[model samples]
Each structure stands twice: as C-alpha cells, then as structure tokens.
Target chain A: MKKAIQYTTLLFTCAFALGACEKSELVDYNQPDMIYVFKDFDSDVKDSASYSFAIKDESLQYDTVFVPVRIMGTAKDFDREVKWAPVDSLTTAVAGTDYEILPAKVPAGAFSANIPVKVLRNTAMKTNEVRLMVEIRQSKDFAPGISDANGSSWYMPGASRRYLVKINDFLTKPNNWDSFLKFFFDTFSQVKYAFIIKVTGRSEFPSGSTGLPYAQFVYYETVCRNALAEYEAANGPLIDEFGNRVTF
Target chain B: MFTSIKYLCGITLAIAMAGCYKDEGNYDYNEINKIAITSDSTDVVVSQQDTLRINVNLSQTMPDASGLTYQWVLYPTGTAQTRRTLSETKNLSAFITEAPGSYVLDYFVTDKKTGVSFQKRFWINVVSAFGEGWMVLEEVNGATDIGLVTKGNKIYRNIYSATNKGAKLPAGANMIQIINYRSDQEIYIFSPNDMIQVNYIDFLKIKRFDEFFFTAPEPKPQGHYLLGGADKILYNNGQVFPVSLMTPPPFFYGLPLIGENPYYMEPYPIYSVLKGKFFYDRISQRFYRAGPYDIELSSCPAYNPALDAFDMNNIGKKMLYAEHNVTDQHIALFKNNNHDSLFIYVLDAGIDNAAIGKYDVTKVPGLLGADHYMMSKTLTYLYYSNGNKVYKLDILAQTSTLLYTFPAGAQVADMKLYLNYDDFEDPDNYRVMGIATNEGDQGKLYYFHIAGTGNFTGNTYREVFSGFGKLSSILFKSRS
Candidate 1:
C-alpha cells in the first residue's frame, strides 16, 4: 500500500511535466500562397532591373553577388519552398564556367531569401560587356503577386524580378547603361547563372551580344514610331526606307 | 509404198519452201478510212518576236466528229510535250507562238462522239532574243504603239502600225514588255482585250490573244510568253508541248509581292523596270512581283509592320499608285491610292508593328515623300513632288532639299530617271531626271541634272520638247 501511493505521486509529476512541454506548438502564420520576389516588378517587360559588377573583388578574384527576394504575404505554418530558376533559355551563360546560382529555393518559415549568383569577372566579360537577362517565375506551390510584371509574370509591383545583368568595368559605356540602371531601374541585381543549351534559333536582340546596341535598336523603333505617327496625321502615312506605307 | 511416201514428203517440203498458201473458202477485203490535214506552210521559221498562224484544211471525213475539238499544241524539238496550247478551235486557223527552239506545231482534231483523233504536226523554228535592244512602248493621242529603240537613242515609233502594213496602232495599249525568251527578245502589248505579240527587231505583229489571263490563274501553258505577266511562273514540268493532251494547262504561281497591287485594268498591265517585273491590279489594290522568289506570299496581306499601309476607306483609292526604282534593291514607292500619303516598302524586310512592311516618311528637314516620287539609279536619292515643287531626299542622311520648282499652276505630270549607262550589264549607272509638265494646253519634257555624291544637289533643267501630247510614261530601252 505504501509503494502504490508513492507510484501515484510519481505519475502525477510526469503528467504535469508533459503538460508543461506542450505550450510551444506549431503556429499557423496564414500567409498568402502568392508571395512575390525581385526588386523592380513595376517596369515594362523590356525594362528590366539592371545591375553591373566588377569582375574582381578587392583581392583580385571573381566577385560574388546576391539578389534579394522578399516575401509579399504573411508568414507560413511550415517551411515553404520558393522555387527559383534562371531565365537561361535566352542566356549564353554557363552555370559553372560563366557564372553560378545556388540555393534556388526559399527556406521554410523565412521572410526573405537571397539568391547568390557569382560570375567570372574576367577580362573577357569586361571587354565584351555581354548582358544576361532573367526573370523569376512562379511555381506550383507559390504564385506571383502581380501579373505581367516583367512580361506575363505575377510578381508584385516594385518587385522587379527580371534582371538585366552585366559584368563590366568600363570607364565610359556607349549607351549609358550604368546610368540607366541607377536612374531608370534598380542597380542592385546579381548575375543569373542560367546556361545556354542551344546555340541557334533564338530571337537575338538586334544588338547581338553587345550590351547597349539592342537597347538602342528598341529605342529607335519606339522613337521613330512616335515621330512617324505625327507625320501621318498631317501629311498622310509615313513611308519606310522602301517607300511603302508603314502599317504601324 | 515407201517410195510413194518419200515422194509425197518431198512435194510437201518443196511447197512449204516456195511459200505456198491455200484458200479455205473465199477471201474478203476491208477498206480502212483515214483523215488528212493540209496547211499552206508545213515548215516555217518564226522569230521569238513573231506570231505563227496557219490555215489548215481538214479532209471531209475529219469533220465527222460529233464535237470535233482542235488543239494547236506547241512542242519543242528533241522530245517534249506541248508547252502550251496556243489556240484551240474547230475553225481552220491555228495560232502558234515560238519560244527559241525548233518546235512541232501539232494540229490535232478529235471527234468527241467516236473518240477518234488525228494529228498533223508542222515544224517551226524560233530564233532567240540575243543581241536585241529595247522596244519602247509609246502612248500618243490616247492610242498605244510600239517604238524600236536601238543603241544611241535611235527610235522608230509606231512600229505596231508599221508591222500591220500601215494600219493605225491599237487604241487601248496599256503596257509593253520586252520579254527574253528562247534566248531572244519578244515584245508583248497588253490592251483591255488583247495581248499582241510584236517582233522586237522587225516590229511585226506575231500573234494576238482574245483570252489571256491576268492574275494568279488555274495554270495554263504560255511557254515563255507570260514571262512578265502576273507572277511569270508557269506550272509545268518545264517543257514545250505536244501537250500530252492528258495534262492540265499551266498556271500563274507566286503570291503578290510587297507594293504589287492588281491594277484592275481589263487586260493585265505588266511593266518591266530593269530586271524587275511588276503586275498590278490598279483598281483592286493587289500587287504582284515577277522576280524575287523569296518574296513573302501564300499567306498574304503580306503582313509588313514596317510600311504605313494606306487606309483604303479614309484614303479612298487615293493611295495606290506604285513606282519602281530600279536602283533600289527591295524598295517600292507607293503614293496613297490617290491621297497625299506616301509610303515606302522595304520588300520582304517587314517592320515590326506595321502591317505590310512599310513606313511613313517622317518629318524631315525638307519634304521627304510625295504623291509622285522617283528614285535614282544609285539607290541613294529620291525625288518627291509636293504640288509643283519637287524635292530631293538623301535616304541615308534622312534630309530633303528642293530639287526643282515647276512653273506656277503647272502640275508635274510625270517624272522619269534616264540612266546613261556606260555599260548595259552594270546595275549602277549615271542617270538624269526627266520631268514632264502639263500646262493645260500642251505637255513639255524637261531634262535636269542634280549634282551630289550619291545625291542630286542642283536642279538645272532644259526643255526637251513642247510639241508632244499629254505624255503618259517614259522608258529607256537598254540592250538585252
């Protein structure tokens, strides 16, 4: 009888210990399924968030940069996967050789994620000034906040997911790309380490691989159209270099 | 008995060796009837510029067919089916065209009732158009005539009248084309209802057509006769005929090109500007190109975002006139069907956002485009008219300068570029501009020169003539 009373007291103490341990249960943050990322989601699709980086760090090695991705909605119950991939189909970049992208996912229960993309800031990149453009796409688990940001994406406004990045240390750039990034778009974008599997059948910008020529071609088309529209209203329609009416 | 058998065998052998035959009962004789074809000339030689006609006489038995059909098939020498059926009729007359080779003009008659047919072929040799000069077509007094223009500006006008032994030239000649076929040059005159083939050298009428095709056709055999007509593409296995009568006619191929609109004239108007051939339906706004196989066709409106397409409704036929600049590779000048808008075509290089590969000339330093524009042979400068003033524009520089100022109230009727080619083979040649002014009572041709490096800088014109009637078109006949 004495042993049974002592065992009952011990069981009560164990139950109280278990009840005290149950206070830290998993919390449901009720976060939205659609969380946006990227920095400049508000500009036109052709207008991408641009960034530039010197090929070398202070130690004279290749430079590593991180692209910031922020969550748009509330936090989640469990760790959520934010899928990310390089818009590599249009890129001539190689994952290991030219650049790198690591940890293409948002960690569970994290409010923000940083995509580390590093490039071979070598002499070739500085000389060619080759540009790489990428956009963050929505996956099955997560949807974008804004639609048509960076052309047909659901990234939220001001979350410019399309990054037009380059590795250059030029003292004077022809198309003023550095100024354009600083003034027109954001300047804090990293290289997208997507790879180019195909060497042909791509809609290359009119400028080929040159940094500013493609931009200039697009700008010329737009400005010329605006100028021509007025000419047609007063004189008739504008004629092309071929002497035919422009349909635009 | 052995001796008698031997003798009988010997006799049988002898008879077999002598080709002996025996009659079973009575022999019968059958008479097979046949038809004959006769013509005045069986063997003839016609130049590529000459038309061949033969009046054939059919035997009495040949007319016994229920619906006796006739096919004048033109077959080339050395084994070929008929390239085209020049004329099909039951009448005695047969029309044939020769395309640079020895050909067999097959006169075929078939009886639809009995399915019996007869063929009488005549030999015809066609000379090629090598070493031929230009054949200029002139429209005077609202009548059309052909003029033979040899080297050194030697011109013989009214060759159509001369070819017809002094008959007046046709009244409704729309266009003239000197076609290079059979290695020879032949001239074709297009009218509202006829296509007259005239000898390029002799200026003699070769053949006349009552039913010729205009636009993309269901395929007919024209041999090389339709070289500049519509698409200039024939649907054949590339052979001249004895038209295996089993096949269909050759047809018009190729979709309309940039700046080619079908000029709805009864007879199709096809004009050659250098190596380029243009077929336009003036009323329908359908344009066709004779050259450049890569020209976008098939799926048409020929989507061109570079060109400023005329608004057919608001412009209302004001923006459809098209002019070709031989020096410009892929450009065509289009004035609004009749409106004041001027559009340019970069041929197949269609622009983005524009409908048919064209663009409106922007507001430049001076006038850039007009209802009437002329391009230099160098492909650099363009002359456009705004009212009575003609402005010269440097295409590369995108600047316009006044080139010529006509007399007040005198509308510039026509502008032509005359290239004094040092060598006929070279595409680039030094050229001058000829402007025709219509001052109500009379028309005058003025010659001028503009000096610039690939541009016309000054406009100093000399009056060439004042006696001509309303001058319609000007063509420089170069060597073929």
Candidate 2:
C-alpha cells in the first residue's frame, strides 16, 4: 500500500509538470522580400494604362507619367533600388527619342514608390500612337513577385511583373459628347473642337458623375457661341475640315 | 486504474489552490447625486424678432439649485441643422433672430459635484413678422422699392429700403418672386439690368445678379418662375437657366436648356410635377416639353388633326400670357402679327391630346386694349384690365362682364390672384384678387374678395391701400 501511494504521488507530480510546459516564444516564418507594381483599387486594368496628349496644351514639350511600385513583403529601414527595363519586341517607342525611363527607387520605410517616365511630344505621335512595355526585373533587394500565370494566387493577374503604356497626340471625339456634352455643343468636329479649345483655353471637358458643375458648361456654351459669332462676323462663315459650316 | 487516479489527483490540486486565494483590496460604495429638471411648456410658438421665454425648475438630491450649471441650446429642425447656444442660465429669455421655421430647444442642467447632466427638450415654431402678406413692387422716385400689405390690412411702406440700410433696388425692377424650399424662404427682385435676392425674414440682400452664376450672363432678366416646387428657372437673353434648390446654397444656375436648334422661349412656363415643364418657343411659334430629368427641350409630338383640338407644332401666333388655372388646365392668349386677331387656347397640363379647345376672342371687349391680365383659379373666366376698367370674360359662354372701374385718370399697373400652392388649405388662398393702380404718382392697391360665382363678395373692393409710388407687381409672401 505504501509503494502504491508513493507511485500515485509521483504520477500527480509528473502531470503537473506536463501541464505547465507550453510555448512562450513566437515563431518566425521568415518570408522572402518581394516587390511588384501597385494597381489602383478603382481601375480595372491589370497591367496597362493609356494616355493621350490630344487634350494637352500645344506648348507642352514634355510630360512625366508616374507608375506606382509596391513592396509585397515587409518595408525596409533603408532605401532600395527597383530594377526595371522595357521589353524590346513589344516596345515601339525609342528610349532616347520618344521617351526616357528615369531611375526608380523605393524610399526608406516606404511600401510603395512611383517610377517616373518622361514622354517627349514628337510630330510623329500626332499621326500614330507609340507603345512602351515595362517589366519588373530581379534586383539585390527584391525579386519579381506575382507572376502573369493563369492560376496565380494574387487577386490581380499580371499586375506585378508587366505594365504597358499607350501614348498618342491625335484628336478624337470625347467619350461623353453624345450622352452629355451634345446639349451644350451641338456637334463634334475636329475643327470645331480646336476652335472650342482656343476660345475656352481648356482642352479637357469632363462629363458624367465626376464632371464639372452644369453652370460651368453653360458658361462655356455661351462663350463659344459669342466667339463663333464674332469669328464669322470678322472673317466669313467658319467652316470645318469636312467643308460643313460650323455653328454652335 | 493508476492513470485515472493520477488525473483526478491533478485536478483536485488545481481546485484547492484556486479556492485558497483571497482578494486583499478595499472598496467603498456611495450613491451619486440625482438631478431632475422640469418645464411647463414643451411646445411654443413665437414670431420672428420676438422674445422667447421659458421657465424651468430644477431639484437635486444632495444639494439645492446653487450647485448646478445650466445651458440652453437652439437649433433649426430643417435638413441644414445648425446649433446655436441661447443662454447659460437656468431660465431662457432669448430674443429669436433665426429664420421663420421649426426649431428644437434643449435645456441642460449639470450638477457641479457629480458631473452629471440632465436635459429636457422643447419644440419651437418661429413665424416671421413679415409673414403671409402681399409684397408690392413699386417704383419710388425712379428707383425700385417694395411695400407689404399684411392680412390685417396694415401697410408697411418701403420695407425693402427700411431693412436693407436705405439702399433702393435697381431702377427697372419689374417683378417679385417668392421661393420657398425645405426651410428656405427667399424673395427675388428682378430688373431689366440687374437682379437681387433678399432674405424672407429681414429683406436683407443675399445675392446680386453677378453672384447667381459661375460666369454671369448678361443682366437682361425677362422673367423668373418655379418648376415643380424645387427648381427655379430664370429667363435671360432668350435663354432658360434652371437650378435645383435641393442643392446646397449659394445656388448656381445650371446649363441653359438649348435644343438641337437655336430658339427663343417666352418667359412664362407651364409646369407641373406630372407634366414636367412646357415652354412656348417664339422662334418656332410652337410649344416644347422637357421631362423632369431631361436637360434639353424636345419638340412636342405632332398632333392628329382629327383627334386633337390644335397642332402644338403649328401655332403660328405670338404668346401674350400663359398660365395654369384652378383646375390645372393651361390657358394661353395669343395674337397674330397684325394684332387684329386674338385667340385663346386651352390645353391639359399633362395628356397625350394636350389641346382642349381653341377660340377666337378678337371680339371680346377690353381684352385687345388690356395691359394687365389675370386668370381665375376657381372658374372659367379671364379678368383683364384696360385703362381703368376691369373686365371678366367667360370662355365657355363667350360672354363678357364688366367687373369694376377705377377713378378717372387711373391706369392699372398690375393685377394678380391670391394663390398659394404650398398652403392650399389656407382660408385666404385662391379667394381674393389684388389690383394696383397708378394715378399721378400715387399708387393704390385694392383687394377684392371673390365669391364662388367669380363675382366680388360685396360688389366692391374689400380693402384699399394708397401710398406714393408706381406699383408694377404684387405677389403674396407665404409663411411656411
């Protein structure tokens, strides 16, 4: 009986020791640092964006486009360089003539940085659009993350490795002309648009939910009407490129 | 068996350890001071610029009212809620200067010892001192001013100048329009070269012509009208500018309504929520319609000659006056280019076959020479004034009756029927007529109460107010 009691006491001691043992330190998974191009939450484009200089001022010699790059892993305390290059086969714009890719770097303690690309306005862009395809390359600090494969786990496919930009300077009909702007501007013509730009000194007339106030549109209409009348009075009837009499 | 015994022993040891521990901290409890605030009146009505007083009684459990701090707050109950601190005393004796509307008043009593606050809410109705009256637009000494004739037959002359620091309106001010939306009451004074909007409560200047637009158009206001109770439309330089008052102020006019072609629209607009807005395009000599959401004017569908009374697209006459009568039917008066032929067209406010009837009223006495016209809202009669004689014409019976005549050398300046669309249940609405006449620099305003049969109640004017000026228009100001 004495021996049995001693064994029970020993068993209770062992149970108490086992119950007190637990993990007190956190585990580190040590995920590798990765980087990618940041995508706008509101935009549907995965890896591409289109730009036009048609609405820009004629005197604007050069414009810069900033592409945001994000780090998929933890941010660093020191600044890191981001390696990028243009795909040769898919690129139609010459590096030195049509555009210049500026040096890209992620700032210290930042999750994202914008890569600025300086685009030059050339006479050729008025007749034909040029394309520049940029892709992320592996660097000392980061590896190209989020692939363009079909079954990637990333929410946005092809959003990390590649980004394409289409640039042009040719004039085209505004997307909101028929739905909204027609009430103020009766018809759309290249010559009429140019005249409007000259009179209002503004090329961008946005419409839809995020457009300017209706009062601004009315002011523009009145100004354009008066300008057109004065133009016709000074010089005979203003005509469009299509040989049609331009009227507001 | 030994394994089960070992587990039981371990559990017993854990329970014994927990049961042996005891709390060593000391705690004490005491009751907090309770406060009670009471007021006799929870709903009060007062006029604008009048003093509002409220008495309150407060009691606390621990001490008397000496250790209590009080605060009174007032705020408008409209969509644009603004809070104002009225007083920091126990009793409120505040002079209300807020616009005429509904407001909420809150009284708070805080106990200094316990830091507890007790509150009570009260409802207040603020009516304007210049409420529910006729605003007479008159030209005094070649400059525009306004007078008010209250429902009690009291005349307040030059009220605009009195409230606006003696500043007279523009010289050519010809119209007065009152717009009430949500909790806003605005008075617009329009002139040929300028326009001004004033506050309904004090007649203080709110916005001038240049302030009404992003890029101000020419100051040539033909007329101003309301569309569907929420949108205000202004006509200037043969263009229509509409602004929805539901938007926050300072309100700016939207894009003008321009169709596929250039056209000029008459200032008078026939509007109803169901029918949207209709306008007479003088350039085309036709009628146009625009839906509530439409931003441009659209041509009315072609009328069938056999089934329709008249073609909306082919009305080849100049519009003189157009208005909607009591039954919501539209009546328009027009004349040919020669002015020898006069016509009256009746149309439904909103229907497929809009034309109701068309009649030649060229032979109707006093109509061709009339300078001011008013349509009766309760009957099928048209009242017009020429020289000093007022005449009423019955369209269905094709008869004319002389209503009244002013003194010799008196000329009718303006005429209007008392109609308040917002308050249809008011006793004085749609039951009276106001006429203004000028005689050698003296303007006289007369109010006639109409009977059910479209005749004067006593066969004479109920009230007459005379002063110095040349009255041009009279519009009723409502208290909402």
Candidate 3:
C-alpha cells in the first residue's frame, strides 16, 4: 500500500513537470525591432515625383526578427524621375522572400530597397522589442553632386513623401503569434491620405536689364483625402488592417 | 435557413439541368421562299401585248442552307409558244412577252435542302387610251360672275375678270378659247362692278404661293448671328431675356367658299422683290427695302374720310395728294379739285388714265355732280365737254369737231382708243371702243361707228342687245 502511494505521487509529479516544460517550449523569444519612418509626414503628396527613405532596424540589440521595410511613393506623371537615396535601392531588395516587391522589371527610378539583417538575441532578457525610424523624402530627380553628411540628403522638384513607423513588439504576452502577424499585416493594409501643392510664378528674364512687369504668382493645391476612394469604387473592397473591412 | 439553402441548391441544380436541354423552340418547318408580285395595274383589254417583267427575288428562309437557288415556271398560257425557258433562273431579268390574251404568271422557288418550295401569281392588263372631249361654260346663278369651264375631265371655275385686282384667268384659258374655237365651249364674261369677294386662302393656293418655308442662305462671313441662327435661351441670375422677332401673322386677300373654314389663313408672309428692290408688307405697313413708303401702325388715330397718305387730320374736306418725289424736294400734284373741277399735269408725259382720274388731274367732277365740265387732251386732239355734249377740238385746225351725241338711256363706264384697230387715216379717224351699260331696266350694248366723213355721214349706229349685261372692257387676246 505504501509503495503504491509513493509511485502514484511520482507519476503525478512527472506529468505536471512535463506540462510546464511544454508550455515553456512554446514561448517565443524573438522580438521585433523593425521601424519605418517617412521624412515628409504631414507634407506628403500623392502622385508626385518620387524620392527616397531611410530605414533602420535596431534588431542587433533585440532579437531575431525580419526588419523589412517597404518604400512607397507615387507621382502624377507615369514616368517622373524618382531616384532613391542610397541610389541602389533596387538591387538590394529581396526578389522573392523577405521583401517580395514585384513588377519583375524594376522601373528606371524606383526608390525602394531592402537591407538583409540578422538580429542578435538579447542575453539578459528573454524577449525584447526595438524600433527603427526611417526618414523618406521625395525627389523629382537625383543630383549626386549635392551632398549631405547624413545619407547624402537631396531633393527633386515637386517631390513629396511621408514617414511611417511600424513597431514590432507592443504586447503584454510574448508568445502571441496571431497578434504579431496581425500587426505585420495591418501596417500596409491601412488607408493612407496624401496632399500635393504646386507653386508657380513668372518674372523678368534673369539676363535682361530693363524692369519687366511680371504676372501674379499662382499656387495650385489639391488634397487626396483618401487614395483609396477611386480604388474602392473600381475594385469592390480591399482587405484592411487585421480583417477590418474597408472599401479602397 | 436550411430551407433557403436547399432552395438555392435546387435552383442551381435546375439551371444546370436546363443547360443540358436542347433549344427545340426553333425546330419547326422551314420557309424556303416567299414570292409576291404586283402590277402597275390590274385589268386590261385584248390586242395589247403587255410585257410583264418577272422579278424573282431569291432568298433562303431556312437556316440549314448556306445559300439558295430559284426555279421559275410559266403556266396557263401553255408551251405552244417559242422561247419559254427564261434564261436558266440565275437571278437575272426574265423577259416574258405577254400576248393578246388573258394570262396568269406562276412562279416557284427552291433551296439547297430537298423539301422546300414557295409559289405565287399576279394579274395584269393592256388597253387603249381615251380620246378628246368638249365642255360647256355656265354662269353661277345669282352672282352673275363667270361660272365654270369644263376641260377633258375636270371642271374649273372661270375666274377671269377685266379689273387687274379681280380674279386672274387660268394659264390655259386663252388657249382653250382660241385653239378649240368651238362655239359650244363659250366663256361667260363678268362686268367689273359684278366682282365677288374671293377667299384669299383659296386664291393663294390657286396662285401656287400659299404655303412655303424660307431657307435662309448660308450666313455671311461674320456677325450674321445678329440676323438669325439657332440661339440658346438663358436666364441671367433670374430674369428672362426679352428679345423677340415680331411680325404680323399671315392671312389672305380673297373671299371664302361655302362650308369652308374661314380661319385657315396662311400663317407666314413671303418676301417679294419688286423692280430690283425688296419690299415687305406686315399686312399693315408697307416696308420699302431701299425706297420710301407710307406706313400706318396698328395704333393709329380715328379714320378721317379725307385723310390722304395715312394721316388722320384732314376730314370732310378735299385732300391733297403727295407722292414721294425723287428729283424734287416738295409735293408735286399737278391738280386738285375743291368740290368741283380738277386739273393736273405730271412729269411723265403719257396717258395713264387711272392715275390722271384718281389724282383728280382732269377737269371732271368724279362720281358726284353731273352738271360738270370734263376735258381730255392728247398732243393733236383735244376733248372737252360743257354739261351738254362732248366736242372734239382739233388742236392743229384750231376748230372743234362735233363727235357724237350722248345716247339716251346709256351710262359710259370707260372710253379708250380701239386697241384692236390696225390703222388711222385722219385726226378724226381714230376709233374708240366705249364700255357702256344701259341705265334702263335691261342694260344694252350700242356699237357706235364714228366715221371721218367730215359731216357725220358715217355715223351709223347698231343697237346690239336691249337686255344685255354690263359691257366690261374688251381685252384683245391676240393683236395679230
């Protein structure tokens, strides 16, 4: 009777330990540390000349996470020059996996690129999340002659851009794959609005000596409240953030 | 919910089944050909070979055949004649010469399929033309106006008259009278005073200018929009635009027939060009395009009896006449009558009797007192009357010649030189056809012969008719 009781107790203890171990194995130690920032946030324009963005992923100090940033810019003219900063944004983007940007033929001046990164897991903490702030500026064209110490900053005429930062880890529980995936999908799915303004004026020829009468300055402003209105009308409804319904 | 699902599933299944079903609605008999024939006419007489052309229209009413072929057969007037098969039915003209007999043409058609046929028949005729005929001209009973002329088959009312303002004769009226020269087809003549009020609308239709639409010529180089064009009516803020094209509504200038709708007048006026210049009448004021004209608006003062030239001042008194003078800057009336005698001279040195009489140019008391003096003169002969008789004063001889005594029971309507006479030998040898209607119970015609025998020896008179109507002016149809 005494032996039977001791064996039963041992078996109960082993079962409970096994359950705890399984729970621990399921925990996700990887934390997202990717961030994307657009330099021209409020002044961002739609269908304007293209420009560049700066994407940073501080994942080396956090955990193993895919720090993929998508660079998006639009312009009215189909073929307006939009050279990217760090000019080789094209060759750097992953063709199929981490950042699968498409239209197999890369356009002449697309300012989209990716940086492959391997994050180092945090030693002291089991999980940690980091942010990467990227600055995006639009340009009608690029002037390699102009230089700035911080990533060689330059502008194209009539260029506009916006900054968008995405946080990877902002949750109470670490092993939330569903929530993490939802956030990842929601970043691109939200509807974005952009505004564009054009300024024009006429003056005397720079080379002439006589005083010349000049026409009044003209400014044209248009607000693209939601870029998705026309798109939604044409193509039923677009998938929105995390199963949220939106017509765009 | 489950029932709805089942219903949707059932409906989908039914649709699928229906797709498998063959469309048998179109699986009926085929109509290979539809043959129809029409004649220029239906019946005819013998001895005339009417060549009826058979038009064989080839069509395949059946959907099975890609194309069709036609087969024609001639029947009833059987194979006893030569050249019967009309050129092997290749959608070409088949010449079937019909002879002097009653005949029926039978036609047939066929398709590529073995079981398709259509047939039909038509009737024809051949006869001789009709010949010439005669007509009678009768006067309308009470009106005494010229009545009617019957020609061939249609009878046309005689509208001829002596006054120019009266009805104009038909275009072929003179030809009908002269060429036929048949006494049975006599035309009745009406006096000027016997004029009837002709309906203006019917008269316009007779004149062939009743209804017409004017197509404006292509607009000029520029600024033609001011004249006429398609315009968009628009309101400024709220008020409406007030521009309008104003003109009088059209009407006629004649009398109406019995049971005719009197209000069916022409609604638009046509523009007329006179003497190389345009003239437009609003049915009220006469507008001269490049000249002067007298005009009266709709809102004019009271009618004055003696008001001349559209003025309303001078009433119950003798009025002066003033025509627009081109060379002179003043009114130029040669004469005026103040209750009695009128004498007038004009720039045109010719005899227009109506202008002279209406303008009161001659010394004749018009239409009133008969104890009056009347005078008329040409270059050589002078005519003057002093209450008793008319005397022909020879201007060359400076002596008066007693022409003719005014016959009793006669009222002179008009006197003019005999336009029908070919020649004259002396100053007194002139011939005049006088229009006179007897003032007695029955009017009469007196043919007076004024001979130049110096002592009135050739003044023989013939009383033609005692109860004759008014003697209207005699117009020569042909001088030759």
**Top-lDDT candidate index:** 2
TM-score of 1: 0.34
Worst 10 residues of 3 chain A by lDDT: A214-223
Q: How does chain A of candidate 1 score by TM-score against the true chain A?
A: 0.43
lDDT of 3: 0.28
Task: Give the per-residue lDDT digits (tens) of candidate 3, residues B1-480.
Answer: 445544555565575467679877886784444434343433423222223454544444344544445554443344545324443463425444543334544455545566455655544332211111111122232233222211123222333342234544332221112111211111222222111222211212121212210111121111001112111111111111111122121111111111111111111111112211111222222212111111111122343435323222111223222222112111212222355543221221111111111233343323232322122322333343333334553423445565555566455433323222222343322333332343444433334444443222355343333433333322212111
Candidate 3 residue-wise lDDT, A149-239, digit = tens: 1222324222222212222322221122122212211232323101111111211111111211111000010011122334556875555
DockQ of each: 0.00, 0.24, 0.01
Q: C-alpha displacement of B101 in model 1, angstroms?
A: 16
Which candidate gets the maximum DockQ versus the true structure? Answer: 2
Mark the regions of model 1 whose C-alpha exceeds 4 Å error after superposition. A1-248, B1-142, B147-155, B209-297, B300-329, B332-342, B349-358, B362-371, B385-389, B395-399, B406-413, B418-422, B425-430, B434-458, B461-466
TM-score of each: 0.34, 0.74, 0.22
lDDT of 2 by residue, B1-480 (tens): 766776677676777577668887677878877877888879998878889999988777788455888899999886745799999998999999998888998888888877888899999999887887888988877888888887777677888899888999878888888766665677889888988999887788888888888767778887777777766788887788776554224457755776767888898878777777788988889998877645578877788988678898789999988878755588899998798988899988677668879989999998887898888887878889999998888877767888888999999988888866558887768789999999887999898888887877878899899974998888888775
Report lDDT (Cα) of residue B140, candidate 2.
73
> Whole-model lDDT for model 2 versus the true structure?
0.80
- What value does the lDDT take at residue B476 in candidate 2? 84
